[model samples]
Target: MKNIKASMLAISLAFLFIACSGKVQTNKIPNETKYYLPKGVKTSDKVALDSKELQSYSLALEKFFKRNVKADEEKKQDIYQTGIERGYFQ
Candidate 1:
């Protein structure tokens, strides 16, 4: 029947839409590391963080730490902090 064909078409379209509407995971490190070093600087075990890399790494670490601390503060309860505050005598 035409109604059965239409229902099957609708179901197939719905599934196709759902399958295509997914987030694509990318290799973020490849992009981040592309220009991280100076030009002509070959990456190897001998490669070290230049001043720029050092500064960027420091800032990135500081931001990461701050974000984690802010998240902990926003949480209703942090068991580790709670235990440290109540169980430890200092």
Candidate 2:
């Protein structure tokens, strides 16, 4: 009984909030999801990136792209190997 009342109140509040906003919602979404700012907030000079920005981006990413990782072979020690060697398998 208590849960039903609480849910009905919540739904009514949500409908009231939506009714207060008079703006029409659209289904279309922008192809570019962002503009250098956090949360994709709109800015004036964020239309497109030129050659200078591209050059700076490449320079910044050069070190990260050049990294190489080498892994050495570790001995294959299974779980049963330890128990058998310690005379606990019996």
Q: TM-score for every candidate vs. truth?
A: 0.31, 0.25
Q: Residues 1-90, candidate 1: write the lDDT tens digits.
A: 999999999999999999999768785546654566578887566756689989999999999777766677688676777778797745
lDDT of 2 by residue, 1-90 (tens): 999999999999999999898677577665686644587675586578799999999988996776553322245557798789889979
Worst 10 residues of 2 by lDDT: 67-76
- After superposing candidate 2, which stretches have Cα over 4 Å from the reference? 24-90
Error of 1 at 50 (Å): 35
Question: Candidate 2: lDDT over CA atoms?
Answer: 0.78
For model 2 the local lDDT of residue 7 reads 100
Clashing pairs in 1: none
Stretches off by above 4 angstroms in model 1 are 34-90
Clashes of 2: 0
